[model samples]
Target chain A: MAEVKKMATRDAYGQALAELGEEHENLVVFEADLAAATKTGVFRKKFPERHFECGIAEGNMMAVAAGASTMGLVPFASSFAMFAAGRAFEQVRNSIGYPHMNVKIGATHGGISVGEDGASHQCCEDFALMRSIPGMVVLCPSDAVEARAAVRAAYEYVGPVYLRFGRLAIPVFHDEGMSFEIGKGETLAEGDDVAIIATGLMVYEALQAAEQLKAGGINARVINMCTIKPLDTELVLKAARECGKIVTAEEHSIIGGLGEAVCAAVAESGIPCKVKRVGVNDEFGHSGPAVPLLKQFGLSAENIAEKAKVLVK
Target chain B: MTYEENMDLQRKAVKVRMGIIEGTHAAKAGHPGGSLSAADMLTYLYFKELNVDPKDPKNPDRDRFVLSKGHTAPGLYAALALRGFFSWEDLKTLRQIGSHLQGHPNMNLTPGVDMSTGSLGQGVSAAAGMALAAKHMGNECRVYTLLGDGEIEEGQVWEAFMLAANYKLDNFVAIIDKNGLQIDGPTAEVMDSGDIAAKLRAFGFEVEEINGHDFDAIEAAFNKAKETKGKPFGIVMHTVKGLGVSYMENSVDWHGKAPNDAEYETAMNELNAKLAKLEAM
Candidate 1:
């Protein structure tokens, strides 16, 4: 972990939501028995009337969230990522995405976290699943500060937005003065040899890899790509065109994540650069500590640095 | 609205059935059973009860309606077309490519549609949102929605029911087209929605039982809904599958199957007689 303040991204979501509730009285919230996990329990303590609990039914929770949002209430629904995006995918698309309601879906327990709770709880495909829906704004913040900013951004944005929060308490990445935008990302460390673009918790790993690369005489630029749906296309194109080589990383599947997004942009723009993707391989996660599970899936900082080195080569 | 005027509206429901059949017969495919069951309640609301402006479909002050059971778009399309919200000629374009009348009610694609609801169990949820919006905006306008008896089997619909109860969304009214049949067979055989009124009551809604085809009963129920002091309302309208047609009535096969040419002719003749009677008024 870097020298930064300690905070859980979920807590950031909760704190930011409470502040939004004060600003926009129309902001409502629902949790599928996961208020504590996603940290919306904080909001519930403030405004009991605006908080709804739909039990363990993710499909039901999604529909309720859509209903609430449609009624002019900006609802932020939270649940385990697996349940929110994986199980109730149709509900998310049909109920919330179809009408293009201003609902914010904050999913927690993403990647191989929720460690001992096993693979059924962890979601490595939420970003891909949510991004597939048209008009949906998908986001994965790097740390607590960015997570808070992401919530505020989604609240102000006038469409369905999805926020994927990892279970573990990651270190703070961006500073307070760091500007936040929905589709535009921040360049954490500037490098000229290659750009390592990443989203979610993996942004920290990307930063770490960039630091190591900087020490190894390899100039690597690290980007914190918070938005996944309306991806930072200009940034991606520039990274591919300017840097000439790109390495993408995320705590998700290699097939349909930040890698796929960057690759799509590079392919469409006819940019000639060696593009390498660092993420979970074609294998299911196991019940263990988050770090070991991430290591098993080859999503550690060292792995990202290795891939970045290969891309630069 | 008088007793006589309400009776005349019931006659218009017969016309609604006629329009639904015409649209479906032209399109060669549509769910007719639920449409038949849904016609009377929809007509009663649109013609007299709902505060909608045909000239301005996007009037913010207007009450909203969402047809959650979208497979039965035939009925809603007819309602919108007949109510002067859109050209009745547009009914001919239902479910056809490049036509605004999609297989489902798409708010973006179709004019006068408040919400695009095709995936069953979602329309009710959207209606809940509409009602909540009315409350949040401090608007007096109400929100109305209709769903199939078969569609209630979906868990999301029940979840919406619970939320309505929790929120005390008295401005919302939901109607269920209880035709007792779905695509596979009778809803009872397809996993039984389990005493719908009881389920809705358990979900904390004020329940109204009415014969969906009876205009007087529907009018009375609508009045009752308006008179409701508080709490969200749900009307479990018991209607026969394919209500108006002779051979189609009570036939589960007519749920989605379109009538053949000969059958269409017979159905048209029956509708023409009904329309002639209504026009005479």
Candidate 2:
């Protein structure tokens, strides 16, 4: 057994932007004074002329990005998820979403994984807020490779995109050749006993849970749903029909995140499957180390395996 | 700058004001006060300043204008219509269910609208982005934005001003219509934006004070903005809310209220008389 590589998705985001800057000359980056934190400083260092430091004004940054998008330039505005999605929701909705601007919002430090910063800094509600925007394409990549690929895909897409990244370094399980589509979900493992649907940081946890479930003689299917908005109904419905039972996991609230999205898809299609949600159960996350905090919030492979067992039984 | 030119602009402005009344009267809802106050400048930008073509609205080299106080869509729509961006007859359908002339300026729907801006303080940032993009691409195109005195209260406006100044967007011009009144009441009574010119200067802009409705002042200020270097330009235009309509002038009640049929008739008659006088000049 070899040691698995680990990298934070934010790191991938920065590297992706810098790489994309070379390929796309019209690609511009805007940072709300979180260039180093959000990793946009990488792109800024490479192309100082194309980078815009928008200070700490998240709302202004969003609007400025929207404006740049109108002028045939694809601008990626970077900030903490709390500030980008929570604080500047209206600006995103009206300025970016309503007009369907070609602006990518690179929101890092998402979810309870923003360790030691406490509840205020942790944006557990970003998925919900961004998902509500009519034309916004919400994405939460599971690992470094996926995150990098998602950035390229978002760039190729011709509308507003909200990409959430984590502060904690997670397992980079996917290979470089793995396919990453905007509105499609990838089935990580095949099974028949129960389906474990997951997104963002939880996808790795779900895969681990699937392995644990396999050891316990339970064949669990793992689906990595990176694109939250325009949820892959085809895949969700297929999982629902094949497995007959499901457990959804994410580092976001169960109310409006992956859990609810899955529920809606299954319920609307009249699929006869038992669905259980595994996530932060409508509570704020407190200050702690990232991994430990994730475990405490029942966002670990152990918790996911436990939840999947219930659905399987 | 000639008398005939000024009179021509005045005639166009009078028509723009008439469009505002006509549109608001038909919609039975809109911010006519700010729209009327910004009519002359809107006319000036469309008719004289902006190098935009109606046939080619999306030309990359054309100057861009954003109505930051987008509630004054009537003024912008009128200007766009008169400039042949669209038919003026569509003005009557302003704010209607299916009309492209929305309650707020929607850039996607309206041909000449450079940015969709209704939410206060957001449009100026968009304008700044446009200016920055033009600079980045080495394009000669300039960006202009119109904001209300009341709209400036939003903290995002200052943030945008800071960015514009920090970037040294000399091609950007932010025009604040110092229309005394807002939806609540007079701007001084509600939130005194004390010494807007000084505030703009402090924000590192090359500041200019002008009479908004004065064609000569408007022309001179825009020229000075073009000549200025190393920083963004801010024009603090002293304007009367509801400038053209006699009953609506400086009236707080007209801030967001559409004129009734009789009020509309009176407003149109007054503007028509002004147009007649300008024509006779």
Candidate 3:
């Protein structure tokens, strides 16, 4: 493989927001004191008039975004995943979700990738919390290119959406030719032995897992399931039919994350395929380096390959 | 602004209180005490303060009102209906299975509701957001929000107040219905807010204390709010828990209970007598 440029998904989010500010006149950005970290500072620097610094109040920011949405403004509210999804869930649910406001929640530093922040800052359950809200679109982009596209797509689509971004610099595997669509899954490769369905940074790991599986004479398919809410059930069912075994990967918890979503879809289809979930198993993450945490929580490419081997067997 | 106008507003407030009784009585479950206490304020806002239209309830440039104390949906619904946003008949259907007038104000379901708010302390932030958006658009639109005395116990309320002040939301006004009573007991006993005016002033608001039920004071406070500049406005209005009904006033039991048939009739009669006396005057 050639040397791929690496960038944080949040960096892409910031660049995309700056670009969006030039396009959409009504596009407003809000931050809760973490604009520099969440990368909304890029938008703030260019469009200070449209950028609102809401201070260190996530609950207030969520409701403020919802209020702005009522007036036909596309408000992108950004904060760490812990504060945006966990601390201010009720505000997001009641203010934005219930009213179906056109506010996009840019939740940065999602999952265990928020390294050295300890368990308190590392939010691995945001996927579960956001997915529980009715009429909330949940999108987790795989790489920087997809993350940038996801930001534009969320602004174009009118409604409440939670776009999760990560802090660690990951490989930019996706090309600009791949069009981003909400609620649609992309099949990266085709195989027959086992299917690896993934989201966020885990999609790259799933692709790597496919390469590893190929060395062991196992043909593993790679599918990037970006939209978690209106999940691509068609691709999931097709994979279950073609490949008799399935493995799901994410940087989140096994409960209520992509793993459970895939399992539920397979079970609903009554497809008798053995499903394995590769994620943080019903536990909290600790303070560590991002790569080591991925390895510790069985979220790495090798770990995904190991899970795929069992499912294939 | 005048004696005759105040009397007219007083009569409208009486009608608003009667609507509150009618709605809660029909629903058989609601927070009547808060609703009754907030009736006069809602009447003043809808009839006099807000720059809105019944024909175009979703007007973008019009001033916005958010019921931060949203359990008082009856009070808000009554005011909206009387303002010709809907029929009085719709207010009676509050909390019913298919009623648009939900137990809490839903902005999508209810016309003229700028923001749907039920969870305490969340609506103020929403109001601040509306005010911010108006400022961003360079429109002269204003935003008003009403909060309960006891509902200030939520930490989010102070957070919202701080933001409104920090952003210098001069177009925003927050009115705290300081009825001094909650569901458990008196607000001072339940959870003493400790000099709400001082606290709000510290939070950078132009604070005013007034009698919430008195039309003159309510009018003065709103007028001052509109004229104020460089800071958010706060009006801590002193009011009775249940303002009109003789038996329910200052009583905690009426905080979240519907009046029985006899109680409802008695309350309506008292309001009717007051209305008749005002008209004769």
Using Cα atoms, each model's DockQ against the true complex is 0.53, 0.88, 0.89
**Regions more than 4 Å wrong, model 2:** none
The digit string of per-residue lDDT tens for model 3 on A122-237 reads 89999999999999999999999999999999999989999999999999998885799999999998998999999999999999999999999999999999999988999999
Interface RMSD of 2: 0.6
Q: Over the stretch B32-119, how does candidate 3's per-residue lDDT look in tens digits?
A: 8998888889999999989999999987889999999999999999999999999999978989999999999998888888899999
Query: What are the per-residue Cα lDDT tens digits for candidate 1 across A244-305?
Result: 99989898888788899899999999888778898877567889987788777888789988
lDDT of each: 0.84, 0.94, 0.93
What shift in Å separates residue B105 of candidate 2 from its native position after superposition? 0.7
Q: What share of the true interface contacts does each candidate keep?
A: 0.50, 0.82, 0.88
10 residues in a row with least lDDT, candidate 3 chain B = B182-191
Q: What is candidate 2's lDDT per residue for B1-281, written digit by digit as tens?
A: 88888888988999999999989999999989999999999999999999999999999999999999999999899999989999999999999999999999998899999999999999999999999989988989999999999999999999999999999999999999998888888888899999999999999999999999899999999999999999999999999999989999999999899999899889888988888887887
Runs in model 3 deviating more than 4 A are none
TM-score to true structure, per model: 0.94, 0.99, 0.99
Q: List the residue pairs that clash in candidate 3.
A: none
